[model samples]
Target chain A: MISSLTQAERGAAMLITLSGMVAGLAMAAAGRGDPMGAHGWIVLAFFALFFGLLVRAAYETEAPEDRSLAYYDDPTKVGILIALAWAVIAMGMGLWVAAQLAWPDLRFDAAWSGFGRLRPVHTSGVIFGFGGNALIATSFHIMQRTSRARMPGQVAPWFVLFGFNLFCLIAASGYLMGVTQSKEYAEPEWYADIWLVVVWVVYFVLYIRTLARRREPHIYVANWYYLAFILVVAVLHIVNNLAVPASWTGAKSYSAFSGVQDAMTQWWYGHNAVAFFLTSGFLGMLYYFLPKRAGRPIYSYRLSILSFWGITFFYIWAGSHHLHYTALPHWVQTLGMTFSVMLLVPSWASAGNALMTLNGAWRKVRDDATLRFMMVAAVFYGLSTFEGSFMAIRPVNGLSHYTDWTIGHVHAGAMGWVALITFGAIYALVPGLWRRETIYSWKAVEWHFWLALAGTVIYVFAMWNSGIIQGLMWRTYGESGTLLYSFTDSLVAMHPYYVARAFGGLLFVTGAIIGAWNVVMTIRHVPRQIPAQDRPTTPKTMEPALPAAE
Target chain B: MEISHELFVGFSKSFGLFYLIALSVGITLYAFWPSLAGRFDKAAKSILDDEDGPCR
Candidate 1:
């Protein structure tokens, strides 16, 4: 019976299984005096049923291909869209939060509007929502592209996307509702964490099966980064987020680790989260789209290999740098510092390789906004990595730690490196995937490039200067050896920088809106047709051919 | 008072010596291990090779 059913039918069966599990868990939790547990179970059930219905509906009918390319199987396109959308939202939220830091009274005291509440929303939105989506989308795309295989299942692709978004929704909502494990990065309550694990497992399975069916003899460099991302994240999530909720309706939970150990584990997961989610995933995008957009082969394939290994080995140890001068053992701090410094070499190697790929393609950088985005991203990647390494040093950490300087460094990577590369990939993909010959406006692309770049520079530099001044003020002592400036004094000093940062954010958001508009016009106004010749003969090395410049 | 101070100093010196020896050995192993630097070089080359040329 299962064999006779269509792909969509098979998906429905899995969803049914999920629903049953959720119902069972809920019933079990209801037996206890835990309202939170009951609520969690019900939420799980709702998702399962929703997915089940979707599967059933999908199996009952076939989609019209001419309407829009079902890019689920085309990992590259899917990855690009996911990355871009999340990057926009992430950066937007980040700027909002930055503004809040500048003027804490900016937002009216709505339950979800407060900085304490929305900060996690912004962080998770960017890190997991934007960053995580980027990893999954790129990994899927890279995996399929490198493997020379279509994605494994029709429903499976939707499962990854929808399930992931569902989890993000739950986590973000839970934060506002005051349901949390109270962990720094892993703030989602036990139920949300459990749901994520299930979603992640499906993601892993989808990637593995797709890879298994690959036509290519060997996987690409991007695939390695994606695989490492999936594997490391799975391990990290399970280990750090081990917790038990107090009750079902209660948003409280307890971690397995206590005191110093908890602190260590949190940073371990936190910093690596930045590494795998933000760095590794964007590196995958950089490797694949940079060369592809530039129409050039990578500069040195050997350098990519060394950098990957170097980053993987060194980054895990460097998480301790976040705990510099903490109660954590001094030896651990030393190790973190050492590894962080060493990381600079590999990080620079990848950045250098990306830059060099444009050796003969300088004209493309001039004409193609996509290539320009990628190039700018590469420069930011270099800057962020250098700043990160410097901050990991104990002496430097003493000054920059817990300051806006750290915030500046992060945005430099997120906005400048990750978001820029994501935008480039999206611009390159939008026209081709939607069957448009050209973007609605080349001028808009150029406008976005300059505006966003200027915004990023203004935002980062302002934070950097303010952070250093704040750090200095905090450290400065009077002749009597007492503290020179009060904490609020630093806030007063930051007002001008904060206003500049807000202006920069506004510019960046404007650029994003322009981009979104360009994409919409390309999708709607542009004509769509799959020319008979453009269809793949056997699905090996097939891509939509670029139209000649008009 | 002088004799007691000398004996206490001698005990501290012995412990420091053992710690230094252990530290040196650990450093030596980290420097020599193929897992540390060699693997990084190899991984870097592999990725770069896949990029500029055909995947192996």
Candidate 2:
């Protein structure tokens, strides 16, 4: 069975096994005493060995000449599954942490289970793992199809995919083990950060080379957005993660930045991670899938180009808005706030472009769950971006910052826009990648849509009201000029809202489960009987294997 | 090389902002450039041209 794969597949399989062996050895050395470490090595050993065997077991096949003509890849297939799996985990983590806040006893006395540790897991898991994989999978699919050319080489995409996921593993496991720099979103210690840097560089090179191979006259506007996302994210990851490790094993590290510089650096990394990682990449998905699904032309092709450059230029400087009223220079804070406000222009441009593109396609939007997901995602994109700019102003930040209001804002974007759009992209891709007519069940897609909608609405509104009440309570004063309400009073008030938020999260995860079911069933339905008639003699044996008649 | 710190900062603050604004405006104009309307229209519908079959 192993003999059927191309030379590249076999080479990749062997490389994966060797890397696992090296990981296992490293784990034995570093985790010499810790079960977590020992367990990590053992898992790597098994994972590598299993994949090696699986690759070896794959039935060998010779590709027909027509197969290489247009480049579509299965890395995307693996990517969407990883994205859904991460969504389930990250949403679960979000729910657990929210519960812990409502009832502190939920920590269960395990240090790793404590809110402090798991919070990073929730953030990193959703942002990098879930969002990152969706971007990777969709970008590869788009690049190949839009360019009308194969990726320059095959193994690089897999290397970037697996390598990035490996870094996600290191980051998550390290956080639980108390190995972190404690920098908001850049929490992974120096080693994990470095590994990500390497993976990101490979991703960038692969993108550029693929674009270089494009037969299309103009690199579709979608590829441009995806490319900008790759390029900007690479720069941000490297600069923000510059750190000195205490040991060679990379379990701990110190930032190259310090004092206000460190704070600024961290938030710069934090916000742009939102910008480039979440916004930019997903916008790439929107550009392609929204138009394709809406059965409409992009409302304005030029607007996309303008918005792309506008966002790329302005977003880099807006990170300092997270540092308002800090020790950072007043001028810098003002500059950050200015850029943050200006960002609304391009953001709306992108959002409006998408919404306008759906102008004539509202009937399709009504009928198609996948298109509805994209359309609603566009609306949330507009809504959250408007809110983001409002919060950046120090006066507004004064009330909203350090409250569940901020949490609500983040989730509105994360849950509403990011996850929703990813589902849309995956829904569009699943049938195409597997060469099926459509999903196994549009009924499930409809279920996911409403469940996700109800959850987001409940989660966000509950937080908004709770946050405003908490902020108002914290500031209430008596005639005696003494504070009228203690912090605990606000906590007591927030109790019910916390419960609602947790319940909202439960709904979110349930929707994701439905989505996962939809994805798996769709893939399973794609016919796979072609290899048995492996002898390629025009259409003699192949004709009957085709699912066209179905 | 001999520029004062304030001068350098001022230059960056003013020139950089202006350059970006100009570039953004330029791209927007170019996109809506009347002559390019047909090209943009075709590009918008490019996903459907000459496909092997219905991708449905």
Candidate 3:
């Protein structure tokens, strides 16, 4: 199998195999001590030799025409399939956890099934698996479309997909096994972290090589956001995960930073992971798909440049706000709060720009379900950014910091913003890529929109009320000025909100299922052929022509 | 103590007024300058058109 791999594929597979084998040997040798280190070295050496042979064999085959668009469509379709599947899994797990919170008995007595493990699982699944796949798939498609070039290699795209899913599996399983660094978002152990590093480096190279071969005079704004996401995420991942595992299988690791410094580093990684992974990557999608769907030029190109710089400069400092009122220095907290407030300007700028792109296209907003999804996503993006700034304020943090209000705030971005934009992009992609006239049911799309919108509203509002109630009850004093309520009182107060949240989650999940079915029927029933002369031609002024259909 | 606190509050409020005016002017200039320059260029072109005198 390795012998049939291309250079990029072989490089990726070798890195995975070498890292696994080295880690395995390291565990075994550490148990035995002395002279066993050489044995571990020998195993790595053999894999390295095998890797070289695979590369040679891979190069011996006759190379396919590098200019053809045939390879682009296949990988792009695979990415879409992977993204849709991950969306279901991620959202399903999210609803399950929501139910668990609503009724503690829903956990079913399994250790791994509890909210403790499932919380991270829900977060990582949606953020990394669902949202990350959307970013990769859309970036690949948009990059190819904007650059007007074929992707670099046939086999390399498959490597990225397989390697990424494999890393997700490792991270998810490690969370269940209790193999964590005890960090909030960076919980994956050393082994999984290193796996991501290798995958990301290949992704970076793939992006750069394709961009180098572009046929367009000016790179689209979407590509800039995608490239920024890829570059900044790589830096953040390496910095935050600089740790030494006690042993390969020990399930423990020590980060390089300690004390307050460690707290700072963790939030730095945490917040930027949201920035680059969640915010910037999805901004790339918004930049490309929103305008295309609306059939309008972007509202302002200059606003995009200003927003890009503003988000980059301010977001890095805003991480410290997450550690507010902690042992972190007071000045750091003030800096964080100030920058977070500043971040609102840029976030709103992009949101306003997206909304304004639909100025003359409001008919589509009423008619096209896809445009509605994107428009709602922009609205939620504005809402979430404002909420984020508010939560960063010291006084607000006192009440809402540890409450379900924060949970509602996060899902507003993830489910309402990111997932909605992704769905719109995918809806647009399916008809174009698969040559479908229309989806199976416009009625189903309408159902999905209402169900999800209602669910998000019910979920966020319940949490807001519950959060404030809990905050007030906790701070209340008796007639004699003694503490009025026990800590458990707040938990009791949250029960109704938790139940409402689960109901909201159920509606959202139902909508997702409807969407998945709609996509499936469209793919299965739609015709594949477009008449030769009737096919759309690539615009000469924008990008080079695609390869003639075989 | 109350009188001194009130006096300090009055001083702070006046200083805040000054800060807000300066900030508003700065933002207005930043937003409008580029558009103003574009208008100036358009005006200059019209003047050149008049100087060239009904060429056809």
Q: Write the per-residue lDDT of candidate 2 for residues A45-122, one digit (tens) a residue.
A: 655765767566655553423434335466788888998899888888999998898889999999899888999999
Query: How close to the true structure is residue A158 of candidate 3, measured as C-alpha lDDT?
Result: 59
Better of 2 and 3 by TM-score: 2
Scored against the true structure, residue B1 in model 2 reaches a CA lDDT of 65
lDDT of each: 0.73, 0.81, 0.75
Worst 10 residues of 1 chain A by lDDT: A541-550
Estimate candidate 3's RMSD in Å.
9.4
Model 1 scores a C-alpha lDDT of 0.73
How big is the positional error of residue A201 in model 3, measured in Å on the Cα after superposition? 1.2
- Where does candidate 1 stray beyond 4 Å? A1-88, A529-550, B1-56
- The best-first sequence of candidates by TM-score reads 2, 1, 3
Specify the highest-TM-score model's number. Answer: 2
Which regions of candidate 3 deviate over 4 angstroms?
Answer: A1-66, A69-71, A531-550, B1-56
Q: DockQ for each candidate?
A: 0.06, 0.38, 0.03
Task: Name the best candidate (by DockQ).
Answer: 2
TM-scores, all models, native as reference: 0.82, 0.91, 0.81
What part of the reference interface contacts, as a 0 to 1 fraction, does candidate 1 reproduce? 0.02
| Candidate 1 structure quality by residue, lDDT tens digits, A456-503 | 999899889989999999999999999999998988999999888888
For candidate 2, give the lDDT of residue B2: 75
Scored on chain A only, each candidate's TM-score is: 0.89, 0.91, 0.87
